[model samples]
Target chain A: MPNTDSILRFEKVTVAFGGDPAIEDVSFEIRAGESRVILGAAGSGKTVILKTSVGLLRPDSGRVFLFGQDITEMKEQDQFDLRARVGMLFQESALFDSLNIEENVAYPLLNQKAVNCPEDQVHARVEEALTFVELGHTLEKFPSELSGGMRRRVGIARANVTEPAMVIYDSPTAGLDPITANNIMALIVKERDVRHATTVMVTQRFQDGAIMARYKYDRATETLVAATPGDASIAGLKFLVMKQGRLVFEGTLAEMEQSKDPYISKFVLRN
Target chain B: MLDFLKSPVLAVQEFVFLTARTIRNLPVRPHYWRDILMQMDIIGVGSLPIVLLVGFFSGIVMALQMSRALQTYGAVSQTGPIVAITLVREMGPVLTSVVAAGRNAAGIASELGSMKVTEQIDAMRALGTDPIQKLVKPRLIATCVMLPCLTAIADFVGLLGGYFIGISLLNLTSAEYWTGAYRALEYDDVAQGLLKPFIYAIVISMVGCFYGLNTRGGTQGVGLATTQAVVSSIVWIFALNAIITKIFVSF
Candidate 1:
């Protein structure tokens, strides 16, 4: 049975570049307010899936449904309206180098017609978003002026500024150091908990997924606390393991850990 | 073999599609007026000094060369008409576009190629803005509008250079030079001069955008795209100049 609450659905989608399939026959459904951590090695099509979900890359075959509308054959202009409800952080943070942090964060608000954030309120919203990422003081700075971790934080602020219904992070901590990577993960957790936005994170690090599964953000304490057993938020969390353009595992953390398959086991045992 | 020809053929198809889409979007809603103004300031105002310098030098050289040829035919006084005709018909538009193609095309390619390799282009798409509408159209409009304006300036500057040379070196009066130069220009010559740059602007902006958008690999790819943009824009500028000039000549 199809979950009518699904925020994003990829039905037997195959995406290719230059006659080479980047992702093949992949199917997944992300429901509203649920979190999905997609784990894979480089070139496993994790990023491709995220891009296709947002209609950045159209699949060669199969259909993609976002917010109950089929986007597979939607015109580019129509996709822009649909995409306004979704936010994405690219692997490199992908901040517009030409714009300062304030403008970068305010991009969707100013550009997304569906967002329709009025001109007068744009500054306040940008400041609030930057404050959410703890980078309020860096508004005047450009992406090139910031450190790698700072840029990623700015990217996060930009992605969430629209208060999107769903947020996708593509390897938000791909090249960061351990401490910084954990800090980013904590922010992701905080965002997911606070906004209750549907979260889809793609990462190569098992620890990133582990962190998502094991912890929940406590608003009062403003810190991550271990979820009590069978907590609904934690229970709603799921894992997806991809290998060479194919989804090999999709289940809870425990189910993924208990898998007998060598590839799935490798991901679980790595950390 | 057909396999070898596939890449270039596909590239041509993509270029045509990109151009068509850009033209189609010209009247579309949500027009990025701010972006268009910014690009105009960059591509048009930024290239003014170089265009002026090139135009001046080209005129001086033409006057100097034509003086010697006219001396043999006892037509040394005809230097102004010759220089004016050449500048308006050929040298002014060609030199200005070549300059713009070198300056703006390379800049556009590197700027956009960097954005592509870093996934900012993808990010733009995901952020609910069409990269083509936001990025490419502004450039296309700016270049198309500005290139001809720049060429007109270059043409006037080139005439000034020729006038200076005619008075000092060729021993002609200002009246003699200005009168000949002014009378030499016709509506047809001005039309051709302006028309050529407008066409070259399309080639320069579109070729740069096409290569930039398709860039891959990384930083190295940006450098490659910049080079390709300059080379291709200049090549197309010359090829197009010949075709346009031939049509004008036949008319």
Candidate 2:
């Protein structure tokens, strides 16, 4: 389905590593204030898509537009200036080993030209961001001393401290226990609910599809479709499933459930 | 072994390509340059005292050994000239390069490699910051400037060490050793030794950063790259020193 209200749009974006396809000609739009999830199994190029959006990897072809500007072709200085609006929670959390939690959270903010906050105010804001992740007590701790969940929380805090309009989360639940993953997912959804960010999440977790109402307005059909829950189509959601870089299932989530296709049935079972 | 060579070559090619990409993506805004200068001081200045101490001791020992061997032939007077020539033309540059490979190269490699492994380098790129300009260029610039200066200091101090050893251990007068030393060192020897560290610094900084930027596998991969950067940089320093000496001193 075509989209009109996309704050972020990828037009035929393709990324290849060593001439082998990692993600190919995949395109999607994330509207402003929308919480969209890219769901796929292992080795399904999910993280690749997230990284490309944040300009970590350049596409071999096609353009990435943010708010009607071609960000892919923008100069580095321009991109750095533009990045105040976009933040990423890396898969590994990517906090500096030398930096304490406060310094890590305030990193992006300190780099900003507009932030006039003093050191104490910066500390306060870092504390505030950490509190959002329920990490207020760990302010003085170094990144090396933090546990994996704590590290992810720190990453999220750092990514959002600048109050970015767009936030990208790459595998926010990987390598965590069920409860912790659920908690992280809930925090992500809560941010989407309370903040004005266009949340772009890439996850393999089967439960995330059901945890929130991720709706997309299909311009061509002029219909509001949603992502299904319980790792299956909830009621009526417009889903376009891709496998091996080709769109396989493009229909309402209910239609996918009702289909007799063994692949769909097997996918449902596997999830 | 075949896979090993193939992979490094592929990795080097990728590094060059990525470096080119970074060059094109060079940021116009200046980052916090004070941090870069401090990193240089850490890489170059922090290593200076050790390099100088090593240089002086090596020269003094060499002079003592040579004077003992030459005394039987009544050629003990030649000790100052030999010590001065060797220190200025060979030992000073070579030793400083070795120290730099250990100090600066390892430091640059580990910093960038850890950044790579942890995804901070990728984060920089994601935020439209060029790692080469932001991280590598300052290091390379700092190394190129500092290594030669260290070499010069080493040569001067090394000659002084030889002078001190000659007077104390060789039963040679200070006047005699200074006279012989002054006679043997042409500006040619000083220039030759002085030139080697420039290339040495460049090689160490570039190879260190290239290996780091190519880091894969995770923490283990970054650790291995850091070790390899130091070792390979040391080997290159000595080999290049020999090659340059042979070229210039062949006459």
Candidate 3:
């Protein structure tokens, strides 16, 4: 039985590359308009979970439901149609090097048959998406021409261009200076709050998750502001801690702070 | 023993599946005509000078060698027919394909290998573009269409090289060489020449793509894949040539 309100549900899903399972019996659900930050050390299966959620990697066992449909065994062609409703920014940004910024960002609009954005509007929409990331002038630039932060921003813009129902970010701010990382996080927050799209972010940095939980993007001031108590967005922000290939913790930031497990505390206590 | 054999067996299985899927996508929509044409320029047009150079040299060498053997029999004037028949039947297709395997297979492997390591392939999939349709099919189609064309050019250039040797070195008249060369090529030789390159095109492009999309590790893995693509494509080209030639001879 699938829950209609849940946008992504992983039910005891296990994925293995060769011998050992990369993600074992991982189960979690993200409802509409909610935000989840998955935190883990290197090789803790964070990216694997993100890939599995979107049907990029099929599970070895159990089931996965996206938009309340069992997608565990969905054919790849069918998955493409279903994936049109979801946007994902892969680790390293993954912008096609051969395509310039405009073509890269316009890829989803043109390629995704399900998105089916009209031809006449694609350039305008690409410009608007680039503008949203404050990269309006970089349409002709290649990915190599941009700095790391700029490339990541382009990735964010591309992900949000289709205005998908949910967007997944894999280590959106993994290897950046603090300022750039924060700037990237602010964009993610803006995307989440403005679109009210379901957001799932995987990060190695605990600060990334903390920012996601505590801050709300304020359109009026064009900055991230502290969320007031009882803020609905704050309530929907949850932290998921993964150890090895298993989900060790799932709760609010406060619950994570009160956790006594050394592995869990390692994330909250460290930078 | 089982563990040692596992990866090789799995690799073969994956290759088979990949080949089948690439063939399946030939008629599918979202053809990416732009990509196919671009690959044509890269694989076909890009390989032209090298194919020509190789063809010319191979022709010159064959003429030089065959003339010596013919001179011993007082038949040095027959250099044109020998070179032409050899070039059309076997040398043109195999040598041109071998050159393409070295050039384009390595190119495709490194390009796609970089993309794989960088997660561009996964991103393509997530963006609702089937990588097989977008990446593999275009290369396959372009190679299939262009390799045979390149082979034709190589065969002609090779015949011209044989002509240069026949007139300048052998002291044979233009009519003597051209007549012998033109008359020596049968329908079977032409068919065999074209068919060999067509089959090699499928092998080179698919093997390059297979090694590329399956690349692992980092930069080191990309280098390994590029080398593997060239070696495997060349080996497969030779093996397939022998098989096809044997069948043609039997017929």
Q: Write candidate 2's Cα lDDT for A1-271 as tens digits.
A: 3345666787888888889877788876666665565666677677777776766667888788776567787766567666667888999888878779988888777665544456667878998999988999998899888889889988888888878888888889899988888778767765654565777777665456545445433336634345435322223224445555533554544565576877665765666
lDDT for each residue of candidate 1 in B141-181, tens digit (9 for 90 to 100): 99999999999999999999988899999999999999998
* TM-score of each model, in listed order: 0.98, 0.83, 0.99
lDDT tens digits, residue span A1-271, model 3 = 8778989999999999877999999999999988899999999999999999989899999899999989999998898888999999988999999999999999999999999899999999999999999999999999999999999999999999999999999999978899999999999999998899999999999988888888998889999999985877777889999999999999999999899999999778987
Task: Note the DockQ of each predicted structure.
Answer: 0.92, 0.46, 0.94
CAPRI level of candidate 1: high
DockQ of candidate 2 relative to the true structure = 0.46
Whose lDDT is greatest here?
3
Model 3: CA > 4 A from native: none
Model 1 C-alpha lDDT per residue in residues A1-271, reported as the tens digit of each score: 4478989998999999989999999998988888999999899999999989988889999899999889999998888888999988999999999999999999999999899899999999999999988999999999999999999999999999999999999999989999999999999999998998999999999889989999999989999999876776677789999999999899988898899999989877886
lDDT for position B221 in model 2: 88
Q: Model 2: runs farther than 4 Å from truth?
A: A1-5, A72-77, A112-121, A214-242, A245-271, B1-31, B49-53, B186-188, B242-251
Question: Candidate 2: deviation at residue B183, Å?
Answer: 5.2
**Which predicted model would earn the best DockQ?**
3
Question: Tens digits of per-residue lDDT for model 3 on B172-215?
Answer: 99999988888888999999999999999999999999999999
